[model samples]
Target: MKSGVLKKSGTNKKKAIECLQDTTKNTIVFKIKSNYFNENYIPSSNTRATTNFANLARGENRQENLRNTIQMINNRFNSLAKWDNPNDDRYSVELEIISVEIDIDGSGTTFPSIEVLKTHINDHKTGKRIEGIVGNNFSSYVRDYDFSVLLSEHNKGKENYSIPDNFGELHGNIFKCFVKSEAYKKNFTKAPVICLSVSSNKIYNRTGNHHPVLGFEYLSSKSSLTEEYFEKMGLKVRYFIPPNSVAPFAFYFSGDLLADYTNLELISTISTMETFQKIYRPEIYNANAVAGQCYNPSLKNQDHSLTKISYDREERTGLGIEQGKFAEQHFITPNKNFLEQWSANFTM
Candidate 1:
């Protein structure tokens, strides 16, 4: 089915335009109130701890921690030394953060909402905003997730049990709201991208003997309903786990941005089996891990292959953290086949 905003009323157009104008100014980072992360809230015993920067919300320094994490992502992507696309003259990619707040009522219902709060362009050596589209505005949600059973189930295991039935519909509504706004049509007529960093403990690799492949859950399940819906709107989706990142992030984009190979290059450069092993359970990414095992979503009987690469000791040992860890990491080293496959699979 199709996704994104479908209705275009005069009032909606006016509001969207206003939102776009308000966000496009010189503002870089927008900070939310501290109360947004309530200390009183606690997760149930059954719920597993969230990975990556998502865990920052539980601590007292939620804002600072998340900001630091985002800054790292920004710095890594903007580094020209790390990304040199031989296909294009552009040597760098710039990204911005657009923080949005979504409110969940006491009954655990997520109010379909988003607000563009901050935008940060990466630091480039040229000291000028690199031409062309400067990547996406990192949109983040500003509410806790303990109360929602749907979120808990989808987020806290070796495999996602199920996604919210309306997950795709909500994203569709949000996309509609975003596109209707003036900023989207005027500046991002090509369609903007949304990058989300969240937990992926439940996503496992079926072919690697059930070894946890990063972001596998989102791609293989009904949880991908939102992504499928977005694809119908001519957008593309990609997911990856950064080195030492407990959770993986999803990127949705359109136009030339979708064709750009920078995101995957950066991710592969920074990530290693050891890093993933440390963040997730070691048993998953370890060298001795077996192959052919798979994870079956309780709701769906089908099985999804985790990775084409075997996770045997030889393969696992070959992936050393030091290989790609350098300030001036290798450029022109992205996996082209992987990129093409991902783009084809997610783009309708």
Candidate 2:
């Protein structure tokens, strides 16, 4: 779907987001707009994170998905740690999904919808390393509901749509409301920053950068709905393929993502995103080398050779969709009334 606002759907309910354009068309970042808000409200823990960073809300087969997702998380941790022998515990990286309660409904009713990652890392002698933490790809649920579902659905059927004059403003405002919600304020210390894989179909030319960060320019167009939506979320996008990594990752955040996160956190995300990238976008990450005259990439027209990693990534795509639909049905769809309350009442 187009970026500024999503395509419309079967339902014609004039709910919260439909009016978002009119109510908050010129809003900016929550941190920037708020006169008295803490930048680091919840300081980054020296150990595992609060799970507020990227959480999974409830689902229909909630217990089952939770169990499977946790297993996936543990597997990801093990694969990245190179725990070749699953039976052996000499070297292990573990993640436990602990329940967190929050009022997501906007109404007074609470949902045990949030889950935090409690980590336990072992290195032969080093028993306890990180305390607790954790991703978009790694999320138990789709955290960017507005960006992924709401806006995308809103713009679906339109063939010749003009991005609103205040596209950034409107989009950012919706996110701003989400960030400033009471549940968010209570659960998170700082504002949110997340990462997404660059589209495989979009051709991106590598830009000059001395560090691990490899800048990229869209070979097709300067801006995309994804780019603008993220900018409105208060971050600029840059691609980075860290030292000794297989592929480039697009991180969206304000200031510097590398600087903003701790070394362990960075390692965790690299393990999460790069591994999945290696699986899902194998043409790029798994490529022996970029083919053709230009050393650049067209991931769809890829050159790939699978590397050593267990677990069937191809099988998990369906699970990802199921998880998303579950989150949308349980978390986002039911919350429309709340979002409406949010949209009509929100201010710049």
Candidate 3:
């Protein structure tokens, strides 16, 4: 099986603690509950050519969201490839997606633990694999199990229901284990870039530019756990509103998220993430006075800022309890059978 569980119970604890130290070679580890590895000691083998990074949001209308995300990707590619689109074909390059459910062990009633989506990107004319981007669409069985279940039990019945000081450490380490596997080494040529929504807490502003980047002038008082978690992962975060995009997106990467990738490769991720944001939070992306405004010759404002406001949050905490309950009912609970099967079958 792809799931790699160490057989020796005692060594598991040692291995878990060892992961807490500072990384030696582009690897970062952080403190988490020791018991986290007691049962799930080893990480998944990830033998399949896939990545756990997913930009999708939780809730109903998920399939529709996926379809829309694909359309956006094609549209964005065509826009960016004007030279390649003189005749206005379907796209300058096409990204087709295929997905399969990881039944964690195949015992789930019908719903799998999670689904993995892989995109095949090719040049429209040559039909050659030119863009090196694929593997998206992972569900939150890992999130549900790690955060909602394990973390809950770890801090259960505490006074004020206190959580550990290392709130995001466990998930981050598990994620590290996932990416560093031999399968990942075998599959890809570079480190992964994960794209997701910008913080609802901050108003993003962008300077008008043909090539884009974040204008992070308006600093916030505190960092979100999401920001801290990625920091612990040794990843740098940048926010950008892609050309013709409605809102900004938070991109986490070990290297330059922009420079490390080809234009079409980069656009593939941006399009998927931006479409995902628009679908899940219409109030944030669509139901507003503006989508993405391109200001005429951006000039320094009163605060000496070069950018203008793009989005601000009302009350949507991306990690709120309501979101958890929804995913648990729709995705996790139905896939419990698979988790059990996976647990029993796991071994070194």
* Most accurate candidate by TM-score: 3
The TM-score values for the models, in the order shown, are 0.37, 0.53, 0.55
What is the descending TM-score order?
A: 3, 2, 1
Q: Whole-model Cα lDDT per candidate?
A: 0.32, 0.43, 0.43
Off by more than 4 A, model 2: 1-92, 96-128, 131-133, 136-192, 201-203, 212-221, 290-299, 307-338
Tens-digit lDDT string for candidate 1 (1-348) = 111111222232112222321222211111111111122323221111232222333455555544443444344443323444333332333222122222211122122133321222332444655323322322212111211333454567646465555344333443444454544444442345544432233353332111122322224343554456566434676554433343334556665532453444333223322232322233333223232223222212123223211223443223222221210122102322432333233311
Q: How many backbone clashes does candidate 1 have?
A: 8
Question: Mind giving the per-residue lDDT tens digits that candidate 3 earns over 1-348?
Answer: 222111222233222221221232232222111111111122233211122212222235434444455555566666656565676443533332322122222232122222233344556676676644543333333454455555677778776765566555534543555456443444456676766665765545554444542322122344665677677556667666655554556677777765777766776565555544554445444333343442211111122211111122322333323334444565446645643443333221
User: Between 2 and 3, whose TM-score is larger?
Assistant: 3
Reference-based lDDT, residue 285, model 3: 46
Query: Which sections of candidate 1 miss by over 4 Å?
Result: 1-59, 62-71, 78-80, 83-112, 115-124, 131-167, 186-190, 196-223, 229-234, 238-250, 256-348
lDDT of 2 by residue, 1-348 (tens): 111111122233221121112333432111111111012122111111212222121224334433444444445554444434455333434443333223332233332332333344545545546632232332334344444445555578988654544443533545555555543454344445455666654555544453533222223345667777667656677766555554566766665665665544454555445554564467776677632212344556445775433234443444444444555675557665654455556674
